[model samples]
Target chain A: MSQEIRKIEELARTIRRDIVEMVYLAKDGHPGPALSITDIVASLYGSLLRVNPSDPEWEGRDRFILSKGHACPAVYSALARRGFFSPELLPSLRALDSLLQGHPVMKKTPGIDMTSGSLGNGLSIGVGMALASGYTKKNFDVFVIMGDGELQEGIVWEGALSAFKYKLGRLIVFVDHNGWQSGASCNDVGGCVSVKSRFEAFGWHCQEIDGHDISAILQAVKNARAETNLPSVIIAETVKGKGVPFMENDNSWHKRVPSKEQYEEAMKILGGC
Target chain B: MSEYKGSREAFVAAMTDLADKDPRVVFVSADSLKAARATNFAEKYPDRYFEAGIAEQNAVAMAAGLAACGLKPYVVTYGGFITMRACEQLRTFCAYTDLDVTFGGLNGGMIGGEREGVTHQALEDIGIVRTIPGVKVFAPADAAETYALAKAAGSLKGPVYFRLGSGREPDVFSPGTEVELGKLRKVLDYGNDVLLLSSGFVLDRVLKAAELLKAGGIGASVVEVHSLKPLDADGVVRELERCQVAVTIEDHTVIGGLGSAIAELAAERCPCRIQRLGIQDVFPESGPANTLADKYGLSPQAIADTARALAAGKGR
Candidate 1:
């Protein structure tokens, strides 16, 4: 493997390690979403996004909102690794009075672009953020990380419809299509689960990618920025609990925090940490 | 004391003034331009005026979308529809995330469209929006005060709900009345016997209540609680402390409106005998605004009667 690809994989491993450690310490955090989107976030922040951790609110900085906020561990882990906050602070997740709550809070957490937990509402907020960037002529793109399960909310379509009406070209959405929700797979849950075609029909320039592939993720974002006429959706197919042997592809990790022993085992599986 | 200016004319007037300074101050509405007095503002500033048809929900969602793109958007429609029908959108995208939105709702009471019956009434809107944190709810009593509230709501840091009665509400305050969200304005000062507080479209009723009390040789202090959410605790407690009787009059309902807000404030801080005179808990019957106010015991006389009873230890 090339050095760049190897480095990307290493960063994803570290992010997953932090996710496991934090959830294990808190004894209660959704590891599935975090693990699933680790590579997607790493690719965005590490490679594609035009953001400054030092100047987090820079007028022209790219915006990212976690619409499926329950899976905040992935984004938070990425933010910590991106040097927005200390990686050491990751273990404080879910503690009382900790800045890191179970869900991402815009006011509370730096690098968190919007306060979200309400499923399907995050994209609406993201629509606003993207629109705001366009309105102010800030020239910064807005990114929304949504979940397939969260797509069931009627408000998402309401927002989706508005995004197209405004032709918010800078709006980029990455749907974590891990195929599982809190109940079961998204297909079992009612509503439009075909995120790729849904966006295309909504007039969004659409593409589907393997979410774990850093190179593919980078290419999708670059392609989105190049599109001048319409918004874009990268419906990334990801595996819930992606890396660790026990957690990978498991629905139980939706809100499961790894135990201390399990954490060690998972980290060791990534190779003797 | 400054005359009580209503919010309806006030909101448009403020928008007109803002349109002069800021080119991006856009007003999106669901076909109430003439009633909201936005006709002149629209003509004067056509670029800033956007009529969104008869869709309140779509209008709000569009405003949320506009706000996303950094446009300062003020959405106008009936209080009943804007807060009730599109409440989910308001809560999800606007209030929860603290978007920069100004919602100007008219017919705040049974003020306008009372002829249209229960569906058009905005009796519960103030109470409904008060529950959402971080959003300001302002009800300006008269025309001048309404304009002031509109300016503040427009330039406000976060989301705000500004209400005004429909049509020609009495200009309670003289011209140039100053108002702010979450601040209470005292109208007439009474010594220490009765305190009568009122909100939008009911300042005249409040004034009448005070005069009736004065005729009966009871001093009644009248206050305009324009800002409802961050309830003016200090003003309420101080009024309760000096008063033997308290009466809250509004053009809204018994549940979650102005009366309950004042009563809750009084009960928690300075407990006192209180009579909340407003709409009944049932859907209001179609009639003239004044007729319905009387039928629901919300007129000045009814408020006076209830207050006298509370003053005489007679209300249940």
Candidate 2:
């Protein structure tokens, strides 16, 4: 593996470790979705996105919104790792007056582009940002990370259609297709509707990839940037509760905080704190 | 007080003026351009005006996203759909985030869309939006107030829900009335016997009722509460304290509208025989604006009669 790729992979592992630690300490948060988008977030922040952690609100920086906001731990860890805030603050997740909220709040957190916790809101906000970028003559791209289950929200499709209609080429969405929802699998809850086909019908430049692979995410983003006619969606097929062996693909971890023993096991598996 | 026109027209004119002055200002409508009088804005600033079909939810969220990009976005639609359908988005994306997105809830209250029935009425829009923490809710009584509030909404920091009545509303203030945010303006401060607090297009009715009560030797004070959410508590409470009887009249339902807001305040601060004169917890009938207001007991005579009853030691 290339040295740069290896470094990114290492960062993803650290992010995963932080996600587990944040959820375990807070005893609150959705770790399953957090872990599901770790690599996608790591790839975006580590490689593709033009951002300055020192100047998080720089006008020229690319914007990122965690639409499936329950998955904020991964993005929060990435922000801290990117030097947006202190790494020590990660343990204070969901704590009173802490910068790391249960969901990504823009005013509270430095790197968060838009405040999101309610499902299906991020993409619409992203479309706005993309349109604003055009209006202001800024070339900065807007990225939104959404959960697979969040697609059930009718607003998502509404935003999808509008984004396509407006020709928001800079608006790229990464759907963390981990399959499992809070209590049941997405297919079990809502009938098997191919997310890729849905986006295709909406006229998005849709691509499917192994979400765990950092290189694949980077490549898809590059390909997406090439398709300037429409908005892009990288349907990253991820495993819910990805890194930890016991939690991997487990629906229980969707909202479950790790026990002391489970925390220790997860820490060891993700190369520890 | 001076100029007379439809609040919707005034709202659209003010927004278009803001769009002309500020490049960052944009308007997103849910295919209600004609109803909202935004065709001129769409023609002039085509790039800034977004037509989001009949999707109020999408329009609101899209406006929030636009605000995130440092642009001032105004989401315009009928008050019913804008407040009822896109309510969650207004709370989550706009209010929670404190985005600079103004929600122009056109055609507010029971008298807004005459003959359109209960579905078109936005009686609970103010109550619905007032509950949000960071959202500033305003119900303009006339074209002047609507224009001033709409102009101010573009510059406000966080989310603002500006309630505008449809059709021609009586001129409650002069064209250049200094309508400050979170300040109540006394329209008729006649007597200390009764104080009538009102908002939206119903202020004209309350003022007329105050005149009738004054003529009948029962003095009534009419105050126009433009801002509902950061409600001028001190001003409202002060007015409430001065009178023996208090009445809140609106074009909305008696529950959770101006009446409830004032009653909630009166219950805590000042104890008085309060009469909430509005649609008394019932679906307003479909008819002309005047007919609906009259049928729902929200007309000037009905309000005056209620005030007369309250002043005569009758509990409401």
Candidate 3:
């Protein structure tokens, strides 16, 4: 692997460690969802995104929205490590008065583009941001990450239709296709037949890639950015609880707190940054 | 009174005027642009206008996104759709985020959507929006008030919901009337034997009701409460304290609307005997707008009768 990819992989490992730690410390969070998107978050924050942590509200900065906001631990970790805020605040994941909220709140947290906790809302918000960029000639891209199960929401297709109608080239989305939702597997819950074909039918530029592959994730984003005439959706095939062996593809970890022994074992596997 | 005009027309004109002054002003429609009479805005500022194509949820969320990006967006559609269908988006995306987005909800009361029937009437919009924290709800009494409120909404910091009327609404306020946000506009102030608190297009009917009360030797004061969320609590309390009986008249349900707002305030501050003159917790049928309103107990005659009875201590 090249040195840059190695560095991003290392950052991704650290973010994974942070996600596990934050959820373990909070005693309450969606660990599986957070882990599923850790690499993607790391890939974006580590490289590609043109954002200044010091000036979080800079008009020229690219915007990022976490549509499946229960997965916020990953984002909170990435934002902190990206120097938007101190890394010390990572443990205060869902505490009252903490900047890191259970869901990503744009007003409370730096580097957050839109306040999103409700499913199927981020894409529409991204469309608006993309439209605003075209309107004001700001020339900033809007990135969004949604869950595979969130596709069942009717509003998601509405947003897809809007993005296509507007031809929002700067808006790129990543569907963390972990195959597992909170209740059961995505297929068991039904209606998520083919995410790629669905988005393609809506006239989006579509790509499918291994989400855990940092290089592949970056390449997909680059490919998305090249398509300046349409919105892009990278259906990243991710494992539900990635990085740790016992939690991998385990639906129980969707919201369960890690036991002390499990926590120690998970940390041993994740290792030091 | 000035020449009667449609609230939807006035709202579009105000928004178009705002677009002329502020480049960031944009309009998002959910396939209801023609209903909103916003073709002028769409024509003048083609780039700023967006259509979400029959998707109220997407339109609202998109507007929130635009507002987050420092652009003022107005999402115009049927009042029921904006308040009921996309209610969650308005609550979470706009109100929770405290975004500078305005919702122009057309056909705001029982008088609206007479041909389209019960499905289109927005009797519960005010109640739904009022409960959402940080959303300023304005049910303008007429076209003039709607214009002023729409313009004022542009300068306001957070989310606003304007409960507008159908094009057939009669003129209540004259042209160029300055509407202060969150303050009651006193229309008719006679001896305070009874206080008639009115909101939205029903103010005209309430005014007539006040006149009827006067003819029957019962002096009634009519106050137009345009802003329902940031209600003029102090002004309303002062009026309630003077009158022995207070009646709230609106084109919405008595529950969780203007009547409930007044009753909640009066119970805490003044403890006055009150009557809520509106649709009494029932769905209205499809008919002529005036006929539906009259059947639903929102007519001038019914309002006058209720106030007279309360003033004479007949119905305590």
Candidate 4:
């Protein structure tokens, strides 16, 4: 494996471990979706994104928004590990007055480009950020990560069409198609046959990849950045509870906390927190 | 009073002037440019202006997005569609995050779109937008106030919802009435028998109603409450204490708009007999602005009659 890819893979595993540990501590949070996007988020923060850890609000830095804000434990972990905040604060997840909220709030959390908890809002906010970059004659890219079921929101399609109409080459979105939504699977809920086809219809340059593959996530984002005319959407197919064997693809893990015993097993499988 | 001008026209003109001065100002419309009087703005600043094509939710979200990137975005659409249709987007992205985007709701109240039915009327918007935290809501009474409010909203640092009356409103303020935010403008302080505290274009009617009350030998005080939210409670209480009873006159629902706000304030601070003059609990059917205003007891004569009855009932 290339050095960068190997390092990103390691970081992804650590982040997955952080996700399991943080949720285990809080005894609440959406762990399934967070685990699913660990690799993609890891790759973005680890290699691709041009962000400064010291200066989280760097004007020239690229922006990333987790539109699926319930899955914020993963992002919080990524940000913490990337040195935006101390990893010690991870245990304070969901705590009152803690920086880490149930959902990502930009004002509270460092390195959060947009405050997003309500699904389908981030992409639209991302479009605004991208529009700002264009209007201000800046060259920073904006990446918005959304969930598969979130596409059901009419606002997502509205933002999708807008991004295209604006021809925001600087905007990139990734739909984590883990196929599982809260309490049910995405197919049973929204019945969206293919994310690739939906985004293609919306006039975005499309790519489908195994979300767990660090190399694939990096390569897809790299290819997306090369295109200068249209916005891109990488439909990353992933498992709901990716790393842990017991939780993997299990609908029950969508918002469930790992019990003490299950937590031990989960941490062991994730190579320890 | 100065010459009558459309509040919507004043809003569009102020926006156009703001965009001309500040390059950061961008106007985003939901295919209501003609209705919002933004055709000239769109033509002149084509690069800055964006048409969301009848998508209020999208336009609102996009405005939030545009505002997030350091540009001031003014979203224009009918009051009914913009506030009710894109309510969640405005709450979540704009108000929740506290982005500096101006939500310009044109045709406020039952004034405009007489033929378009109840869906187009904006009687419930003030109440709907009032419940949201960190959102500055205003209903400009005339063209001058609309222009001032628009300019203020553009310069303000947070989310603002400016309810613009339909075009063709008589001027209530003098030519250069300085529209300071969060301050009540007392249009007429004839007497403190009954204070007619009003907002939006209804202030013009309130002033006229006060005149009719004077002619009928019923003393009345008229206070124009242009700023709906962060409601100048001190100013309101100052006026309320001087009067035995206060009536809140607005072009919105009596539920959560200025009427409810004043009632709540009065109950807490200056407890007095409070009367709310607005649409009761039914959806009013569409008609001509004047016809609807008359039917709903929003006309000068009807308002004066209501005030006379209220004053007589209190044995003033």
Instruction: Please give, for residues B155-229, the per-residue lDDT of candidate 4 as tens digits.
Output: 788889989866877787665567778899877878877889898888878888999999989899988888889
Ranking by DockQ: 3, 2, 4, 1
Q: Which tens-of-lDDT digit does each residue in B64-149 have in candidate 1?
A: 65565557778888888889988876776678758788888878877555777778778889888988888888877888877776
Go through the candidates in order and give each one's C-alpha lDDT. 0.78, 0.87, 0.90, 0.86
Please say which candidate is ahead in DockQ: 2 or 3: 3
Q: Show model 4 residue runs off by greater than 4 Å.
A: B1-4
Model 1 in CAPRI terms: which quality?
Answer: incorrect
> For candidate 4, what is the TM-score?
0.97
Fnat of model 1, as a fraction: 0.25
Task: Flag the better candidate by lDDT, 1 or 2.
Answer: 2
lDDT of 3 by residue, A11-104 (tens): 8899889988998899999989989998999899999789999999999889999999999999998899999999999999999999998899
Off by over 4 Å in 2: B1-4, B314-316
Question: Which candidate model has the greater TM-score, 1 or 4?
Answer: 4
TM-score of chain A of each: 0.95, 0.98, 0.98, 0.98
- Give the TM-scores of the predictions, in the order they appear: 0.88, 0.96, 0.98, 0.97
- List the candidate numbers ranked by TM-score, top first: 3, 4, 2, 1
Q: Looking at candidate 1, what is the lDDT of residue B209?
A: 77
- Model 2's CAPRI class is high
Residues B74-155 of candidate 2 have per-residue lDDT tens digits of 8888998988999998888888888888888876888886668788888889889888898888898888888887776666
The docking category that best describes candidate 3 is high
Best by lDDT: 3
lDDT of 3 at B70: 91
